[model samples]
Each structure stands twice: as C-alpha cells, then as structure tokens.
Target: MKKILLLSDTHSFIDEKILKFVKQADEVWHAGDIGNLEVTDTLKKLKPLRAVFGNIDGADARSEFPLDAKFEVEKVTVWMTHIGGYPNKYYKRIRDKIKLNPPKIFISGHSHILKVQYDKKLNLLHLNPGAAGNHGFHKVRTMLRFELDNSEIKNMEIIELDKRG
Candidate 1:
C-alpha cells in the first residue's frame, strides 16, 4: 500500500502543519499555483515530488516540473496535470507510445475547491485536493490523502480547516 499526500493552490504560503501530516507519505503531489520555486523546492526536501505547471506559477515549468506526467507506482498508473479539462490535449502525442492503455488515477487542480469523483464504468478516479492556502474566494485551507492497496484506491479523505478557527 502506498500513502500519498496531495495539495494545491498554496499561492505562496504553506502551512507549517502540512509537514507534520505528510512526513511519512511516499510521495507529495502539488497540483499547481505554488507561486514560487521555493515552494516546490521546499516540498522536495520532504519527499519525492511530482508536480505540474499551474496557471500562475512556474517560469520554467515545462523543463523543470513537466506540464503533465504519467508514471506508475506500486502497480498503479497515475496521470498528473494542473487542470482537469485538457487531458486529450496533453496526451495526444503520447497516446500511441504510452504502454499503459488505461490510467487508474487522474489528479488535477485549477478550481480552488476540493473535489473527488469516481467513474465506475470507466474505472477512473479523479482527485482535486483544492487550495491549501487562501485564494480564489476560498478561505478554508484543505488537503487530501489517498491510500492505495494493490491497484485499488480506497476512498479519498478530504480534510478542511475549520472556518471558525
């Protein structure tokens, strides 16, 4: 089983508490809007990082973080991108060369709100961890965690900071 921590839209501030929860995760995925290279480098210090180009961040993102990434880990295949609507545009060139015909998980960010949906017919899992910082009219800080056993991904757990706090 692989435990993965996913977060996005930090804008420029990362909660120090994030380090506490993500310490033992195998990988940390930042979907986009990190606001600075320091944020990416900061998370890299914690664990292996897999990131993507966000609309607002990254000056040299394509060469460095990759616009989209496809990789397998622990028998699971995942596609990472900063936005949810452009999968076809991103995968068009690689469609023929990709060895894995079907992806088990798709992770994306752009909307600053947490969203998780399952397409049972297609066997697709979509996860958007939302904004981990204040941005886009969202005052709540949030993050997501996924537990994968074999090739099956269990329920996604979305955690949001209390508004009153």
Candidate 2:
C-alpha cells in the first residue's frame, strides 16, 4: 500500500502544519498554482512528488513540471492537471481527451473548493483537494490523504488545516 498526500494551490505558501502531514505520506501529488518552486522544492525533499504546473505558475515551475501528468500508480490509471474541470463540466481543453480515454482517478485544482465526487458516467473518482495556501478566497485550507494498493483506493481522509489567515 502507498500512502498518498494530495494538495494544491499552495501559492508559495508552506508551513509546519502542512509539513507534518507530508512526512507521513509515501508520496505527494500536487494539482498546481504552486506560485513558486520553493513550495515544491520543500515537498520533493520530503517525499516523491507528482505534479503539474498551474495557470499561476511561472516559467521555472512549468519547466520543472508538466502541464498534464498522466501515469499509473499501484495499477490505477491516473491523470492530473491543474485546471481540469469536474466530470461533465470539464474544462473544454481537456473534455474531448478525457472522454476519449478516461482514467481510474482524475485530479484537478483551481476552484479552491474541496471535492471528492465519483463520476458515474466516466467511471472515475474526481478529486480536488481545495486550496492549501492562504492566497485565495477559500475559508479553510485543506488536503487529502488516501492509500492506493493493488488497484484499490482506500483509507481516504480529508485533512483540514486552520482557517485561512
């Protein structure tokens, strides 16, 4: 089993509270809007990181991360992007592609709204960990934790941090 920590929209923010959870995860997946590379640099130092650059990310971040991250983990086909919409309302840029080839798990961030919905039409789990940073309108900072093993995703937990300050 692989313990995974999923977070996004750090916006150049990282604190002890976030790190504490990061240390427990076997790997980290970032959806995007990193704002700066330091946030990811810190995360990479602690665990394996899978990330995609966001709309707010600059050249350096984009250079280090891809616009879209597609890979399989523990037999689960996963696709991650920064601005991918959820299910039927998916962003136009990626809508066609997703319909053509769906993944077991699809992740995206940008709405800064925590969501964990199963897309029955596509047969996929869509996740958006909300905003982990304090830059947006989000009232609560959040992240997600789950375990992936033998093609099964289990032990899902939502980590809620202090109110945005």
Candidate 3:
C-alpha cells in the first residue's frame, strides 16, 4: 500500500499537527499556495514532497515551477495542480490546460474546501486536501490522507484540525 499525505493552500508555513502525520506517510503532495520557498523547504525536511504552483505563488507566467504534474505511485497515475484544470470557474485557458494531460488522480486547491470526487467520464479520482495552514479562507482547518494499494484507492481520510468559527 502507498501511504500518502495530501495538503493544500498552506499560504506559507505549515500546521504542527500535520508534522505528526507526515512521518507516517511515504510521500507528500501539496496542492498550492506554498506562499514562499520556505514552506517547501520545511516540507522537504519531513519527507520527499511533490507540489505545484498556486495562483498566489506569483505572476511569473513562465516560472521554473510547473502548474501541473503527473506522477506514478504504487502503479497509480496521479495528477497535481494548484487550482485544478477542471474547476468550477469558467476559463478557456484553464480548461485547455487540463485537457492537455489527463490523469487518474487529480489534486487541486483554491477554495479551501475539503472535497473528493470520483469522475466516471475520465475514470479519475479528484482529491482536495483543503487548507492545512491557517490561511483564513475557511473557518475550519483541514487536510487529507490517501491509501492506495495495487493501483486502487483503498481508502481516504479527511482530518479536521480545528473547527471554523
């Protein structure tokens, strides 16, 4: 089984509670809003991290960091993005970006909402870990855990660190 820790919209800095979970995960994926390079550095100290650039990362159109990524883990194809190519928003450019490369598991952030979707059309798993850091968009603090084994998603966990108030 592949144990993975998924976090999103940190905005910079990370949750201390998240640190405990990171040690138990084989890999970590951050959806976006890293805020600064320091966040990445901190995450790396815990475990190998895979992440993407969020809208707040900066306005550099052609920055070295990619907005999308495809990775293979435990024989499962996972896709990573900040806002997600297939989002609720309406933007032709964004739509086009996602269409360029389809993946089995799609990860994204922006809304600060903890969500998980199963898309039959593309046979994909959409996961949003919500915001691990106190970015202040939502009233709750959330994060996710994914369990994959033999190319199948065995289970998932949505962890609430604090209630929104």
What's model 1's lDDT at 74?
75
Residues 56-135, model 3: lDDT tens digits:
88754216457877889878888787876344442455565556665778888887988888766566778888888776
Cα miss at 21, model 3 (Å)? 1.0
Instruction: Quote the lDDT for 150 in model 1.
Output: 84
Best by lDDT: 2
* Candidate 2 C-alpha error for residue 101, in Å: 0.9
TM-score of each: 0.83, 0.99, 0.86
User: What tens-digit string does per-residue lDDT give for candidate 1 at 1-165?
Assistant: 888989887777666677765786888988888786777788899889888878887576545887677888778888877765433432454444332464787777888778787646446676788888766767677889878888777657887754412
lDDT per prediction?
Answer: 0.74, 0.96, 0.77
Give the winner by lDDT: 1 or 2: 2
- Model 1: how far is 118 from its true place, Å? 0.8
Instruction: Rank all candidate structures by their lDDT, best first, as comma-separated numbers.
Output: 2, 3, 1
Model 1 bad stretches (over 4 Å):
86-101, 162-165
Any runs in candidate 2 off by more than 4 Å, and if so which?
Answer: none
Measured with C-alpha atoms, the lDDT of residue 114 in candidate 2 is 95
Ordered list by TM-score, greatest first: 2, 3, 1
